[model samples]
Target chain A: MGKLKLAVGVAGALAVGVASLSALAAENIRIGLIEPLSGPIAAIGSEALDNFNHAADRVNARGGVLGGRKLEIIGLDNAMKAEKTTEQLKKAVDMGLSYVIQGVGSNHALNIIKFLDKHNKRNPGKEIVFLNHSAVTTAFTNELCSFWHFRFDANVDMKVAALVTQISRDPGVEKLYLLNQNYAYGKSFQAAANKLLKERATDVELVGDELIVPFGKVLDFTPYIAKIKASGADTVLTGNWGPDLHRFVKGAVDSGLGATFYTVYGGIPSSIGGYGDAGKKVNLKQVTEMHENQDGLPEDLRDYMKSYIEAYESTWYPDRYRWLIEQLAAAIDAAGTADPIPVAGKLEGMTFPGPLGEVKMRADDHQMQMPLVVSTLTSDVPKHLIYKGKDFGIGFKTDGVVERADTTLPTSCQMDRPG
Target chain B: MEVFAFSLFNGILYGMLLFMLASGLTLIFSMMGVLNFAHASFFMLGAYLAYQISAYVGFWPGLVVAPLIVGVIGAAVERWGLRPVHKFGHVAELLFTFGLAFVIEEVVQLIWGKVPMPYDIPASMNFAAFSWQGLDYSAYRLFMLVISVAIFAALFLFIAKTRIGLIIQAALTQPNIVSALGHDVPRIFMWTFGFGCALAGLAGVIGGNVLGTEPAMAITLGPIVFVVIVIGGLGSLWGALVAALFIGIVDNLAISYDLSFYPLFAVFGVERDVTGIMQDLVRLTTASIAPVLPYFLLVLILIVRPRGLFGTRDV
Candidate 1:
């Protein structure tokens, strides 16, 4: 009788342990962040990761999706290479991570989308959904759009459209020079700029259109600056990012090229610190989703920025990833399962209150329609600047904000849905 | 005329900087019979060290001290890293340096966090040297020209006139004979390697501000330095100088001009609607081809004159 009682007690304890372990497993959803964690743009990747984690923490605090299942983010470094990104994606899948987020390079995103589509086809139940936070390539949503890939940030056309609207209004910009990196994204930027300029600002002359340097290769832009000055361009438009952007701005300042720079990525953190005082001199206009101290910003966003800046001593662009995650969580809850296919199905046409404003994930192409802000860099820090952690006396001053209604662009994507 | 003058000046300045880097690499390659692939990494290290040193000391002191620190590190690397692998032959030495380059980049990223340092021109030298045709020539660039020229003159005189230089020259030609003598040949090799690295470091100190001091700076300038030495002549210092300047000037001129392949095709009466590769070929401009010009020159020189312009021996 004593032996039987001891066996029964042990069995009960084992059963309880198994039950708790299963419960713990059910209470967490894992997401993988595959990005360039160690390269020229590692800083950008790190900042984005920090913001995502901060958003995850907030969600978990408010009782995570699907009846308090905590959101977990696992970061994997892609090293800014497509091959490495594919390897990371495979690794993430092997680790049972169904949801993956990547940005930085459009080529990487396109390749990963192809990889995921192939993988999903092979393994039907185990599908990985990619949430692209930053890569603004139009081809990702148009010609190469995958059911597996959903982009939260505005595409090149949308951002360029908003920029064109602002440029058309500005009487100062007469002669414009277009300088871009030689790549798919850069080519798209150039095409969009040409199309937008024809429609919006016909008076402005296209002085020079040059595809100057390969991405992450150029060390000096003085020669390029000399060409821009010689072109007699009053304004310059470029989609160059990372060191290319920083170096170009510095070269312009050093050479005393008085042309105003209108860029898609002028407000990167490295540019602010790298350009120093020269950054303040150039009329650097950037089309972004968010900037500190913009009027009519929601209080919740202000609080989120405050907490994020205080926790992580860096600034993040297009905090749309946070909203993307929120919608992802809602979709999971709505689907009643953590399966990627179901979650992806539920995410289509999902509307969520984003930091900028209300954002909708269009079912047709999986592109998020959200507000875009065009701002200029100034040395003046406003009193309402909630995200100022340690400003080098450079901050973005809001010029104009294009609403989500104005940011919608036609997509040629015919997404093949899973049965 | 102003554009021509400006491009020429900028090219010469860029060439002088290249020469500073290539001179050391040429010296090491000629003496050690080992291509120091990590030579540009040492240049990158110099910039980072200068940035760190400049934070504590002024830029002047940083400029003086950083190269010295780099020289010491180079000597240590020669004594420890390269000397052990030297017996494995040229391939081994090359592989070691190549591996060292990757290691150095990783270590640099760990320390510097992958973002460029605020290594700008000194405030005193920030003003324009002159203005012509509504363009202001940077005073800092002219300062670089003066410094590099001084270094070249000093190096030329030291190598030509000094007894130690004569010993180094003799050792380069007949290492076994020099080793048989009372003088320590390996010690000379070590010192020469250190000195070569120091020259690269000095180049880095000046080039960092202009090029932007980041981890990728080494990779950006490394291959170009090799091109300079190869095109000029592998072992000839004068050859390296001439090749660097020539390449630099041609590169700048090519970039400054916007001549397209479309015009050439039009001249040949090829008015057909082009698509695919042909369309891309037609759209190609001199500016687009500028970056590849050095490599093009390298290939052409190799095919035509394998010994290079002034090379006494084939590399």
Candidate 2:
């Protein structure tokens, strides 16, 4: 009986000690990283998780944030559903986390924006700011713009502009056909292509434009390829990803459509590897911040790529995500507090030196104005970079970089700031 | 002329793939009076097994060995799993297979993970069989076409001409008579089910690279296989073949042609632009509706001809 009482006393003492340790650890600021971590596109979320963890480690190594308080990243899975996103945000709010980060889909981002707009309005002291790293729908910064929302990645308009610039560069690209998936992003891509093509390349004829059912629905793209062939278009522009892109491109190439494809995501992850020699036939170009074969890389960049490739077995696609963390940490440091309002103030109209070059956050819309690159898949990358896409012996060659100023466009945001 | 030729050619190729998959389902349903809901899962299993085997012994060996392994598995499933549930009515048997499908999918995920395997066309077959105009038709697809045709021919001969085939046909109507003649009836049922699954596994062996070998590959192709079998008249081989070709060609032709509803609306003579919500629906061309064409045809066939094109029993 005496021994049992002593044991109970020791266990209570241990529990209290652990509780006090957690109280000390509670001084760290938490950023809820809400993403689709458990669905068909779970890899996208998990990849971002790795990059976010790396970014956090880099910050913590640099003497942490907010005068020695560490930046803690809390991962929350939304299962790629828009309705579930608010639930995750509410969970984050329940934990008293004042900052949340999300990327992957525009629908999820919009949900966060709507939920937070009401939550921040209703609850005065407990406001959470959303840091968007990759969802690039343009309206988020324009029509449905929120004061608390800051986008770190370039928008659809910016990417479309970059693609159009690539089209302008190639004098051979006379006839253009826009075939995309029939969805909001696809429609937006078509609109941007039409509007931008008319302005920039008046010589390029818009031959045909159609939208098919989005991914997994279309098992065969040969009929669509025939339609393109019949159009006599020299270039095909599509924003197709996943199986949709791979199959469409394969059909076009194999059937001898003889048209160059300018795409949004052509050579991105788990894609085009199965294309075999069909990948080599067409001039497939994609628009992004960076590719493996970008010329004149620094030693730091090369080592970083090597380490990332070794660790993840995937090409590091989202550089803007890293920048998002840097900018957030910088904002917190400058504000001298982890308060969402003050940090958001510091983040808006911020300019920082990213790895590639200087990128800015426009005060008017809180959209990142970063330079975009239009690259083509080629076998002529540097030897070190050859290991990246060695399966297909093809990687993106930097064709041209649309400057930050060129990529920037006017926004129509009318944010109602708190007095 | 070239556009029509290409679409027709591609349509026939797709139809052949469907026939390859559906013929097995037809055989199993005809012989056993059981619809194997987990048939497509066997296809997926074959692909993953082939992929794993190919990594060790090369593609050609994997192609031969994987389907055989799948046949063994199918036989085991019939003997162990299905035989016990055979005493139950059709609905109970169906529920068993339905549950089996989910279990198989989970097991595949547990083993292979939920990503697409890097199973691709063999290097020897990766080149274009021929190039016409500017496009290169893959040699692998032609190989697939040849294998599909061969499978149909072999299955037809084995079922129609062979002595075992005669016994099996007789047993379909007179299981007691066939058993009285000293033939083991349950063993024949087991073999037929195994052979049926083997055909599906073979289809996977060839179709995996084309359709993509992933966990969702089964589910994606699952509904379409039913559409084929249903429209073909369930348990009718010839009917399945014809229906598959019909669906494949119609789907291809719909996508190939850019016909719109504007002309359809013009015939009414009270012509006005479709506005508001109707605008998007009106603008939807044949290409946009191609995805649901097969299902639409299935519904049409069910409403118009419930027995299917050549089905003996009403679906």
Candidate 3:
């Protein structure tokens, strides 16, 4: 009986310890990092989680954000699917998440944005803040841009417009052929590009623009390439990235196609790093969703990146949008309160030093404005052919890239404002 | 002209792949009258197991061993799992198979993390055999074509020539009589199930590198096989072959062609390249049409001729 009493006492003590830890974690700004950890984009999702963890560690080590309140990150794997994302978003909200760090693509973001809008409407004072790290769909800010949702990366429109302006500036470029992934981003970007180019560049003939699957849907791109060649277009503008870009570029080269000027719309830092020296010959220019080199960024962001890199090493460093994660953490911090409602207020028109330059959320829309860098491949060779860093100019800094009426916009301001 | 030729070639290749998957499904359905939803999962299992085996040994060894292993497992499933469920009617059997597919998918996830297995084409089949006009097609696809054809020929011979084959054919028509004659009906059913699963497994072994050895591959491939079986007419092997090839060819051709007839309606743009809202409509139409060509064709055939092309039975 005495031994049993002692055992119960120990169990009570352990439970108290755990409760204290939870309390302490709650005391810190509890940010939610909801991403597809195990699904199709597991590689990107897990990496984003690690980066977020590193940034949180740094913030906590400095005695936490907002008066030593420490940053506690709770991660949930949405698995990059529509059903799983809704479940995870609900779970995150239930867990009292102040902010959510989402993945890079717009399709996933579109689902989350819709969910948040409904959630915000249901709970008037209690709103959930969405700190999007990688959702680059301009529609997020344009039409469906919620006050609660804050983007860290450049949207498709900005990235494309930047590329178009860059291409137009170049005297060698006469014609442009737009090749995009056959999904939402592809459709939206293609439409936007066609519309913008028609309005802007009258001299440049819009050659045969086509949509192909992002990855290896077609092993041979010969037909598409042949069409481009036939169109008399000297330059091919594409939005393919990561493994798809690598595979497509390699496939094109293997087919004995000559080195053509290529403009890829979205590239992550590591993908840029991977484009070693060999990319120089192809005239490959990369315009990414996020900034690559943090050293060139603002002081606050550079320091955050340094600390994050120190904490997580190169595995979760700039290679996987560490700055994007930092920007999300900052937005969560700016909310002051732990609840998502207050955090969401800090997100709208919230300007913070991001890894790129300045992350300013437009008051008219919730899309964050960040610089999209257009860099050329250097002599990094076959290894970093997709992500080489030689021709990286500060490039174009887009202002007001996201239009309010494009994606997600509340019918009126009276609908709901972040508390 | 070149586009048509290549499209036709692509169709044939795709058809052979479909045959590999559909033949197994047809055999299972025809013999047992149980629509085995887990057949595609078995095909996926074959691919993953082959990938693992090929990683250690060579592709050839994996190809030979994986199907046999899958066949054994399939036979075991029939004896241990499905046989008991058979008393619960065809719907229950189908639900059981559907549940099996779900369980298999989870098991696959547990075994191999929810990511595509890095199963690349073996170094031997990595290089292009030849370039047609200017385009270079993978030699592995050619290998897939030959093996599938050989398997089809072998299956044809076995069903037509062998005494057991004759017994099986007779059993399909008059099952009660064949059973009353005391010819071990259960064993024949088991063997047919095993044989069908083996064909699916063989396809997986070849298709793993081509289509990727991922859990989602089964879900992606499962419906197409059903389409093939339904379009081919349930009890006919020749029907399956023709339907599979026809569907495959039509799909490839549809995707290749730019489906834009906007000139008939719109005055602003008369472009052939399908884009905007039309692009989405075309994509949905193309995707839906690609997998269901056999079903559509089958329906048309059913309306005119109750028995499918080369099919003896009304099914």
Give the best candidate by TM-score: 1
Tens-digit per-residue lDDT, A259-355, candidate 1: 8889988877766666655776888999987777577778877788767777876554567877877888899999998899888999999998765
Candidate 2, residues A1-419, lDDT tens digits: the string is: 99999999999999999999777555888889998776556656766787788778768877788667788788999978877888898899899999999988888898889999999999999999999988878899999999989999888888998889878988889889998888888888888889999988888999898898886778778777766776789899888877777777766765667788898878665565545456767788888877666765555556666767776565666778777888899999999888899999999999977555688999889999888888887776753222233455667778788888778788999988865
Order of the predicted models by lDDT, top scorer first: 1, 2, 3
How far residue A42's Cα lies from its native spot in candidate 2, in Å, is: 2.5
Calculate model 1's interface RMSD in Å: 2.1
Q: Order of candidates by TM-score, top first?
A: 1, 2, 3
TM-score of chain A of each: 0.92, 0.89, 0.77
Tens-place lDDT digits, model 3, residues A224-330: 55555556676777777654454445444434344354455323443432222123234566665333232355565556645554554432223224544455456
lDDT (Cα atoms) of all candidates against the true structure: 0.82, 0.81, 0.65
- Candidate 1 residue lDDT tens string, B192-224: 889888888888887777677876778878888
Error of 2 at B218 (Å): 2.6
TM-score of chain B of 3: 0.86
lDDT of 3 at B263: 50
